[model samples]
Target: MEYRKKNSITGVLRGATFSGLLLCMAALLAGCSKDPAAGPEGGVVTVSFAAPAIGQETAVQIASAASQAQNGQSPATRAALAENTTVRVVAFTAATGNPVQANYVAEQTYYMSGGKLVPCTVDDNGSFVAVAPDAKMELERGSYDFYAITPALPLGSDKATVSVAHKVDYAASATKGVTVDASKTYTLTQLDRKCVRVTFVIKKSANFTELTALSVTPSGAGLSMPNLPAAQSVKMGADIPAAAGSETLTVPASAFTNTDATTATAATVLLPRSAADILLTCDLTYTTATGSSRQTSFSSTAKNLALEKGKHYTFTLTIYPFDVSFTVKAEFETTISDWTDVPAPAYPYVSEGRYIVSRDALGSSDQPLHPDWTAATMPAHNEVSAYNALSSEFEVAAEDCNSADASGVTPNPGNYQYTWANALPACAAYTQAGTSAGQWRLPTIKELETIYAKKDGLTGVGSFTSYYYWSATELSGASYGAWAVDFAHGNTDGNGKSSHNYVRCVRDI
Candidate 1:
């Protein structure tokens, strides 16, 4: 009996029943004389994939499960593709043991169908079907080599090369030189999980306040595809690193959850297997009991951290209190376990400036004048007045101590110092949090002195210099002299208006 080629075999043989019929037809034509160069148009090829197996590190798996149960917790949720997945398959002539360009035969994609994978194609409306009427796979009854990849990437004209996206759940398997008898179903090797799960745990200490930033720099492997397909290199993540450079994942402080008073769960992420040791750096920014900000950082290398496939690595960082002089030491511990689902911690802060406050007992003087301070810029050294002319001086109020610098220029103007004329307008023009012009002004002499007293409490807002700061108070009986405060020793002194001193603006709440 002669088998005739049809418009499409995938469209007609969409179900198991139809596929079985095709298999029987191919088996019956097994003895028919057909050229190897031309495919067996009548023969059918059926393919199926096996689910990935759990890793074999029994001790770690058992302990992990036991610990979760003992702690009344569930396994962490993860991003895995086991139940429903798509795979791309390519076929080539079983010429040599290895796949070659000249040996390429045909390629087709498969999707899930009733618990089994079936050859599929996109229809005109973009819905997937068994196959498009215009395109389908037809193979002769012969031995062929097959290569497969899951969570398939788009196939190009050249079968071997394809672009992979950043951080994909990737897997690949190959079956070599297998006889394709239409009556027999071919099961390629199992598609195992090819990536590792990385989780972070922060061990809190009595002196621990907050972890501002953390970054992990990978030397190799975790940020790229495992060398596969022979001679082809594929890179992933935002930027591929050079020989000495590295890629990293920087998690902000807010992304951690304080599960308990002593321990907290941080970010959990997936990375491809690494061929080299992984190195990471953690930076902590915290406040001292005296309301002063302090920063400390430490780095460690996970020696021989190949990051085997389907494994989980837990890194615990413990911070130590500083010495009386504010010196600190930190330690790190790493644990390996079977890969399991893990939930990422939630980020803190509902809105800007909305954060938890400490209930520690303290005097009113221990608090900062402005807990949320916004630092302003001073005028340029060679800058001219932004508002007033060179021959102008702002009129001082009669109350010398109360005589503050007004916002606008005065009618009775005297030799205006470029720095002094620019100072008041710079503060008035400064805007933040809906602050309008005239809201901020040069601090009065007394106000400047008070800031110096409580300056140490201004933690994490920014820093200050020990130099002199301009004050709005005019010097008594001096035409061009204004009162200024030297933060170096909290001394009040008179400085000529022409001199340029640091200008810090303050506003009433």
Candidate 2:
């Protein structure tokens, strides 16, 4: 025959139809040395599509449903479709056998999100169909991948997919941007249910191309808490530790202006805990894609936030007090007459006079006075003065009662032979200058405390008692009377000088 090619064979066709025509052309062109469309189509032969062999697995098949239909094949030649027609091609060094879902993009739009795009879905059922199969369609043309899921198909192993490789794509949009914005605060309905909700207003709409995600950041995204004045300072009705409070804060939409308000709400989320002490201060901040920040202080007694005095607390911050300091000094004070509601002196006043007592109470039980009860210091051997009482005989030193012949000190020969007469001269000299002067007069009961030796509770200021001594401190309204510190149970007691006690005046260096 001369020529007669079907018009359908020469025109534009689908992958299957075009593929069939190309096959015929290739066969016919093999014999002739002519251009494909240039020669006659007389030798065109009638042929049928190969049978879709019934195999355990659809790995072997001549054509898919549509292709079989177009080729006018019998159901026997058209294999009933299997749930998953894995139309993947072998790849070099790629996973050879894994039921791995295919990565894909739309053939029409070539838009795929992570090689897997979910069609609009319904709650109870799958509604989408596969648009492309594995690496079957123009594999080398774009990024090829095995189809992952068909929403219209059953889930689990029951799913059938049209794997596809898509051209690298993006969410090319009208605009692209990153922003930090606060939400226009609405009535923050703190649902008693454990949540704080503030309606935010969108300041603007941002657009981006190929962008798959958006991130929002909140700078000063915190609840406007009331100044947490110290619970003690606040004089709260409840225990300071149990005081409770809250505040109504005013927020504006401009806080998150220039972006989607919803995003602003999500980008910058503020949280306030009832259990936590909160500080409320006015705040404002801004940001780009990088970050956001804010500053505030707490209202409390110790001059700062309820933050712990010696505790470790942390937060996203620029800087914090690792150790801060200041200094102070303390002191001791007193006033002798500061007693409230009490008289200064508890004893009655007395006048100088002579009194009699046992010889021992004067100086020694058997000693004699150089002169008499009112006797004055008399010059004599060793310049010794006569003693009046035995009370201090064992307590007072011989030198304290007498002046020396040549040396500054003069003492007795024996404890019992010591005569008050020997002490008179020194007593007179001291009296002339100033009776019992310069620690040379008489010993205080306290000083007498040292009369004994540290040896056997008999020494040092910690021991010694019984002897009556003189005190420079005059009795209130009385010249000759004085107070004395006694080692007897370590107390303060008194007696008149002539009633006869020891003399040991104190001298300050």
Candidate 3:
């Protein structure tokens, strides 16, 4: 009986020892355990993308502006990844020793929806605003290699070999030794696009009244993948015709929108990354204020242009009139830059009741100008009326200076008061707001009246005074008299050409 009691006590002691050991182990495990937010050993793998890098050649290079085309057309445009861009990601098991031994493990496709990558099966119902959690890629804690492609190309037998045809948009990325730890999110390097964006910036001169239509065809253009092995030919794909040889890309008129009176986004195209002559053929159809229809064809070749991938190119073309047909002294400037949407051109600084002042009255450094004028025998009232009825203020202003003296004589000869001849030359010589010579002219009687009417609403016009202002229109019946407007009283009357008065030069918007 005494031996049995001893055995029972020993058994109780053994049980207590086992319970204590269990408690200690439980406490130790609790201390080592960490919350998922505290960087655990394994968690969800969240993917992100880095920003794209800018090209090295960012300056604009000036080249010949001669109008000639291989196939025909012209440049400013931007191409960007679409919001709903689909991306296929192939994950490979990292090699234990050599990275070259990596083996493909799994692959999945995701789409860019609402600025975030989501699984393909997660239907957003086309709203793109479906409230869903970010895609979670559960990967074991290990190093991995990833290959990503946009528009999700079929992964054929050769994984390392990529086939890029002459497509408008394409991007690819290959990342090696991407360590995925439960500790933090893994971000993929930025995808590199295989094409360049060319934007054509069309600027209109004062002579360009309207742009009825415009189209561009880029000839001898093809795309290539330069990121491949140097020993391998950059060109691939025997099945794609565009990849075999140069192809033509046509930018329709619908892509270009006239944003303002001066400029328009002519066309934007995604050109291939091949070294070839970029020939632009541009066809323009429009009408001039001189009552002539103009159809101009401009073509130029950017020789041996090895367009860089992911770069934006801008080709600016300013409209030149062919009526005079002078040698085009101006040349085109090629600029490498980031993709940007052309801002609308600002114009019509002031809105008159009927007329718009594109810029402030011609003057010195935005100051109010008053120059006297004297012209030979002025047109008769009937003749002046007929001229006004037949032409615009811009036309009348040009004709008013027909008899301006060209003897290189000093203006305001005898006194500060300028004669009619001197006034014409003075207005013709003045330059402001980047205007060329002979662009500014004396305001007509009707124009002066409108300016006075909308004086209060002048937004960006130069300073003005409540004084008599000369008009391009001559007095109806006087031989040496012209019409003038009194801004103070809104009175209109005939005045002698020798009379000293304020002059306000203007140009067509």
Candidate 4:
């Protein structure tokens, strides 16, 4: 009988001594045993395990999962494990020629020792001994399947024991069996892992300056294997930190393909592959200029995310201001040619609708409006569209100039034609000729002064009475009085709220 060898490079000698031939024949005869529990009839097999290069995507997933598990709570931090972290390897063999139901035969922990994984043995007392690069196992002379796991914490043979918290990477090779032979040494290499890498990228807008903290939580953090029972649900989270004075958070270089100096990213996490959807929630906290703090949250779900054995997924979040308003051309035409030229008018350049105001109001101390106020020079100031005195340009309603009825009659019987309460609603209801309803309000004192200073430019366009026009700004110390602009002399003064005056409305660009 001749001994059969598999996965062995060394060949047997053609001519052997009589005694050696007899010994080989006996070993070959013993290799025919069908019982797996039977003692090895062949020579000892030295099995060495080597990890293939986990592609960038897989590496990122591992890092991301680990980061989330370790830092998912308050005061989050990065994971303790790194690229070179020690990983425990375990080997399993089929109990009855079926890889799905396997039995653990050997275990060894390895670390990246000088760029390669060096195996270590755990004694009965749990103490570890630095061993040779390979793990030796003795088995009966027969074919056997091998299943292995890395980062191998003690996850008994059950799938329920495997968790994202443990960060286990799985690999199995059943197509090629290790045939034990008494006369040869067999080696097993290339145990590739089945896992997914996840990365999170956070971006903030310039207007969101007060953002203080950010955190990400992931749902359904568990492993899904083909032969094992489905895994239970798990949640993991991580805190993401932003760079100083920047609109980005700091992420590891391994997480992104383009690592330019200007880009910031969050740490990558690794997770076991799953057939179910993975959901993530992001929470952000910010403070206002008044020292008030608030928190906002956003959610993103990867529907039916079937993470393959070796792939990467990235999630991104962008935080912006709650209120976003931009200047849009009013519905009505604003061309100067549309206005009817009148003789001996109170002001000039009045159109049928609203006027095209410069960004900076005339006589505005912030910046002077040039005679040639083009769009470039007179940029729109929508930020201060409300009542800020520092804003330069604004549109004024031509209603008051059209007629006395459009001037807004007094809502109260007192001397004041319009109180603050009365003025606000009147502006809301006021409409100009050939224009739709708009979000109009009483002009600020600065806006009134601008219209008055530019009165010479509008001398022939529209009619204006030399009287004080009410402004939205109230006297800082006097609750009973509000500021007013006297168009007659382009001067501003505080007047009693009870005192009646002309009313003109203004709206943002």
Q: Which candidate is the best by lDDT?
A: 3
Which is the winner by lDDT between candidate 1 and candidate 4?
1
Q: Which stretches of candidate 1 lie over 4 Å from their true place?
A: 1-81, 111-115, 118-137, 162-166, 183-185, 205-245, 251-279, 283-311, 320-509
TM-score for predicted model 1 compared with the true structure = 0.38
Task: List ranges where model 3 is wrong by over 4 Å.
Answer: 1-82, 95-102, 121-138, 206-244, 261-274, 290-294, 323-509
Off by over 4 Å in 4: 1-41, 55-97, 100-107, 121-135, 139-142, 155-175, 180-192, 206-280, 286-309, 323-509
**Full-model lDDT for every candidate:** 0.46, 0.26, 0.48, 0.44
Report the lDDT tens digits of candidate 4 across residue range 1-509.
13346322234344346578889889888776544334455444455444433222233334566666787743222122233434554444534533332355555565445545566654332234556545544454556554433444344454213333212333322223566455343344334434434445554545456554433323211222222223322211111111112111223233333232212345333444334444444444445566676665554333344444333444444454532111111111111112111122222223333453432111112122222222223322222332233232345666452224334534545333565556655665566655444456666566676667666555434556687778767777777888787777767888888776777776554
Model 3 per-residue lDDT tens digits across residues 40-121: 4655454444322212221331132223233353422222345666666667776543222237666656667665556563
Question: Ranking by lDDT, best first?
Answer: 3, 1, 4, 2
Which 10 consecutive residues of model 3 have the lowest summed lDDT?
Answer: 324-333
Query: Residue 483's C-alpha lDDT in candidate 2?
Result: 56
Question: Worst lDDT window (10 residues) for model 1?
Answer: 387-396
Decoy 2 TM-score against native? 0.16
RMSD of 1: 21.6
